[model samples]
Structure formats: C-alpha cells, structure tokens
Target: MTRRLSLFGATGSVGQSTLDLVRRDREAWRVGVLTANCDVQELARLAIEFRPDVAVVADESCYGYLKAALAGQGIECAAGAAALVEAAERRADLVMAAIVGTAGLAPTMTALAAGHDVALANKEALVSAGELMTAAARASGATILPVDSEHNAIFQCLAGGRIDQVRRIILTASGGPFRTMSAADMAAVTPAQAVAHPNWSMGAKISVDSATMMNKGLELIEAHHLFPVGLDRIEILVHPQSVIHSLVEYIDCSTLAQLGSPDMRIPIASALAWPQRMATPCAPLDLAAISRLDFEAPDEERFPATALCRAAIAAGGARPAQLNAANEVAVAAFLAGRISFPAIVDTVRRVVDAAEPAAPSSLQDIFSVDTASRAAALRFVEQYEHA
Candidate 1:
C-alpha cells in the first residue's frame, strides 16, 4: 500500500532527511505536496525529482523562479502563505510539518483540522500554541507524531507502558558545543562558534538554541503538552554522547530509553513509519566503540534559558508564546551580530518578564502576543546592540 505524503519545508535539513528515507523506498510514498520558504532552486529540484502533485513556496517573490523551473513538469506550483495553508488542506495520508518557527503553526493546524496525521518537526508550533494545536488534534482525530529527537525518544519509550504508569520523563541533551565553556568565556562567543553543534547537523537557529540549551528548554515546554506529564515530572539531563536520546521511568522505577546514532534521520524515520519500522542507511550504534557515556546535571547558573523556559510553562497563559517569540527575536539578533551571546537569553528574560498578555484563546490571539513580544524583545536587543 502506498501512503500519500505532503512535506512542508521541503528544502530544510529535516525535509531533506525525510526525502532521503522516502527515496530509499520510492514505491511506498506518492508525493502530494512539497513546500519551501524561499529556496526556489532546491525546492524545484526536489519537486522535479519527487514529482509532487503541487509545489508551494511560502515566499511569494520566489514563485516566478519556482514556476519557471517546474514548467511543463505537470506539477502545479503556488506561492505565498495562503498557498501553503491551502496546500496543507490537500488530501494526503501523512503531512510532515517541518517548517521552522511560528510560521509552521497555521499550516500544521490546517493539516490537523483536515484530519491528516502530522509528522511534526516544528517545535514552535507546539511550543507557542500547544493547547490550541493539541485541541485541534483532539477535535479532528489527527495524530501528532513528534519529530524532535528528545520528544521522539520519549514517545518511543512511553510505548512500553501507559501514560498513567509513567513516573517521569528524562530528556537528554548533548549540552552542545559549549557544554564545558565557562560563563565568563561564553560572553564572548561568536555566532560561528555557537552554530557548530558537536553532535548533530542542523540549521543556524536550532544550532544556536542547542548551544544555549534553550532548545532543550523549548523541548521541555513541548513535552509538557505532548505527554501530559506534569511539568514537574519532566527533567533535563546533559548527556554528551547523545546516545541515550531520552528516558521514561515508570511507577516501578524501571527506565526505558531509545538509543541510536545522533542522526536526525533516525527520529525522522521513526515518525515517518509509526506503529511500524523502516530501515535507514544510518549505522547501527556501536556501544563498545563509543568507550563511555557521560552524564551531568545541567548548570542553570550559566545556562539560565532552561530555567526561564520552566517559568514560562508554569505561568501557563501567554508566557510560553512570549518565551518562544522573544527567543526567536533574540536568536536572530545574536546570529546577526547585533547582540552578544549572553544577551540572547537576557533579551528573552526581559521580554518574558514584562509581557502579561491574556491567555491566547485562538490562533489570532497567539499571533497578537507574538507580535507584541517581538516588539518588546527588539527594544531589548537594540539596547544590547548599543551598549
């Protein structure tokens, strides 16, 4: 049986990895829709090869290029944000929501509303609008399969027992490239240094988040929504090897963990073929060759982002949305060399502290909060830039 697949963010790292797996078993998936932000060439190239029913680009300006590239390929092409959402509504067995940041939320919701099983790679969709997204999933009977490594690991480990029997979920982090750097030295870190993740290959934004451990922090908020595990029961541990993806403990104190190579494809494959398994070219884990795995408690004093995330989730209303919005602004500023490494979290702290918006009841409310939070964060970023 062939599963129809609609892949959003078709040119990204996760999208590429998903395509790699699909390419392995070409007969199993019939491509329906493939969307990208602005990478017209790569998107067009992938569309030509995969031959999706329709190709959509989020950037309207790139439509001409994409259309020209796909001309006469018998693949319909569309552009702009609305096209992306419309594409999400198209029929498919699985929708891979790989688009990064808050931009992914709407289409993801659309897919869920259409009752498509979503392989969610966008953390911001859940981080910014967990209740809204999950509510939509519940109302529509759409299953949200997590694609982040830690969340995916927990998702797999939880299969051993019921959610009620789970004691705690332990999310492991690589502690990133700056795991051992002193707080003093971290103040002077460059964007080049920050994006060089030691374990996984990822885009700039995520790599920087990993360096600050904010990625794990965001994952913490995401887990709270996905597992219904009380925020207190979920914890973060620094495991530099990245072998033990995540661990779930039951009432009996037994821990179940999912272990694999640090490749994103492992988790992607898991989501792509849920309730079943698919083979990937990824090398099997050689535990003995790895020599030893190390673990340590996350140092909150130096990496306070995780602590900030906990507070955001606990506050419960608009704070998580604010936290995500501010972090996005701050990360972009840090990458642009307009703020120091420490200033990233500092800006997030300031924005999240000041914002007291009402709880978001709808998608519009979430966007309103996001816009206000971004404005506040930008002010803080400006201060840091001039200081």
Candidate 2:
C-alpha cells in the first residue's frame, strides 16, 4: 500500500530523520507536499530528490529563492504561512507535523481539518491549542499519532488496554546535560553549554528546554493532552540513559515500557506504520552489556519549570497557550544570547503570571492569547537586554 504523505517543517531535525526513513522506503510512500521555514535551498533539494507535488517555504521572502531553485521542475512551489497551510490540504494519507513552535499550531490543525491523519511532532500544537486540535481531529475523524518518543512509548504500551484500565503513566527524561548542575552554575551557563544535550540530537531551542527541564514539563503538558490521563496521574523520572522511552502502569500493577536506543526515527516509524510495526535504523538496545538502568525523582527545586508547567495545567484555558508562546520567545532570546539561562523560565513565569487564562472556543482565541504572550515575553527580554 503506497501511502500518500505530506511533511511540514521538512528541514528540521525530526523532518530530516523522517526523510531518512522515507528514503529507505521511498517506494512505499508518495510525496504529496513538503514544507519548510526559510530553508529554501534544502526544501528545493528535497523537492528535486522526492518530487513532491507541491513544495512550500514558510518565509515569504524566500519564495523567489525556492522558486528559482525548482524553476525547471514540474513540482509546484509556494511560500508564506497560507501556502504552508494550503499544502496541508493536498490530500495526503499521512501528514507529518514537525514544525517547531506555535507557528505550527494552525497548520497541524488545518491538516486535521482536512481529514488527514497527523503524526504530530509539534508539542506546541497541543501545548498551545490541544483542545482545539483534538476537537478538530474528532470532528473530522482524523487520527493523531504521537511522534514524540515518550508519548509514542505510552501509546505503544497502551496498545491492548482500555483507557479505564490505566493506572499511571511515567515519562523518562535524560535529566538533560544540567540535571546535576547547581542553579547558580546554570544561571551562568552559555547557549553553547545548554544545547550540548547528553542524549539526543535536537535543535537548539529544544536542547535548551531540556537543559532547564522545561522540555519534560512541556512534555508533561503534552502527555496530559495526548494520553487519557490526568496531571496527577502523569509523572516524570530522571532517567539519564534515555533508553526507556516511557512507561505505562496498569490498574493490575503491570508496568509496560517501550525500550529502544535514543532515536527519533523509532517513534516516527512507529507513528507512520502504527497498529503494525516498522523497523528503524536505531541500534537494538543492548541490555546486558549496559548492565543497569537507573531512575530518580525529578528535582523540582532545581527545576521550577516543572512546577510552573503544573501551574499552567491547573490554571487551564489560555494559560498553557501563554506558557508555550512566552517560552518560545524566551528560548529564542536565550539562543541569541539576549537572555541568560535561568532568565528563560523567569520570562515564561512572568508571562504566565500576567495571563488571565480564559478558555478559548476557537483558534482565533488561541492566536490572540499567543500574540499577547509573545509581546509580553519580548518586553521581558528587552528589559533583560538593557539590565
């Protein structure tokens, strides 16, 4: 069965990994559309390699560059957010949503609105507009497959059990590179040190989120949305090895885990094949040679971001949207050396505090809150820049 596919954010880490897997079995999938943000050259190169029906670059300024790169090819080319959203409606059997931030929220929802199954890699889509996206999926009978490793693990573990039979879910974190670093040391850390993840190869922003343990917090929020579990029932453990993707404990006391090498392809393939398994290039986990696996409780004092995430979840409504929007702006500022390490969460905390989180009944509401949060976060960054 040749599955028609569309990929949004086709130049990021997850997007590149997906392309590696697609290249491995290119004959098994049809490339309907491929989209990227400002990476015109890579997008055009991918267009040449895969010959997708349409290729879109999210930055409107890069349109001519992408168009010229693919000038002679029969593949249609487009640019800007609307073009990217339009690509989501191109009649693909599976849509891979790998766009990184709140910018991805709408396109992922649009894919669902167009009745496409989404292998979702964008946590912001759920973190910012979870109810909206999940509701859109249900209304359109669209399946949302978790592409994040931890959520994918829980999905794998829950294969046979009913939602009611679930007792708890445990998500493992690498504890990141700074799991043991003192808060004082973290405050003085550089962007170079922050993105140096001990376990996973990720983009700069997510790596810093991991450094602060906010990635796990955001994932906790994402888990609440993805799984049929409450925040109290969802837990995080500092698993330094990152070999155990995640765990599910049944009401009967059976804890089932999905174990594999730390590789995004594993989950991407799982979501792509789903119900039926698919092989990935990740090395098989060697249990005996490694000898042991260890887990510890997450240190919330050292990582207040976890507690803030819980607060956002408790606050509900537009608070999570604010959490995500503010965090994105904060992370970008940190990456650009405009904000210090600890100041990242301080920025997010300030924005969430100012939020009057009302339940959003529409995407317009989410975007409105998102816009305000970003504006507030930028103000915080600007103050930090001068101070």
Q: Please report, in order, the local distance difference test score of every candidate based on alpha carbons.
A: 0.94, 0.91
Index of the highest-lDDT prediction: 1
Candidate 1 Cα deviation (angstroms), residue 325: 0.8
> Distance (Å) between predicted and true CA of 368, model 2?
0.5
Clashing pairs in 2: none
Q: Write the per-residue lDDT of candidate 2 for residues 74-187, one digit (tens) a residue.
A: 999998888888888889999999999998987899999989999999998899998888889999999999999999999999985877889999999999999899988888
TM-score of 1: 0.99
Model 2's alpha-carbon lDDT is 0.91
Cα miss at 195, model 1 (Å)? 0.5
lDDT of 1: 0.94
At residue 371, candidate 2 shows an lDDT of: 93
**For model 2, where is the 10-residue window of minimal lDDT?**
352-361
Supply candidate 2's per-residue lDDT for 224. Answer: 90
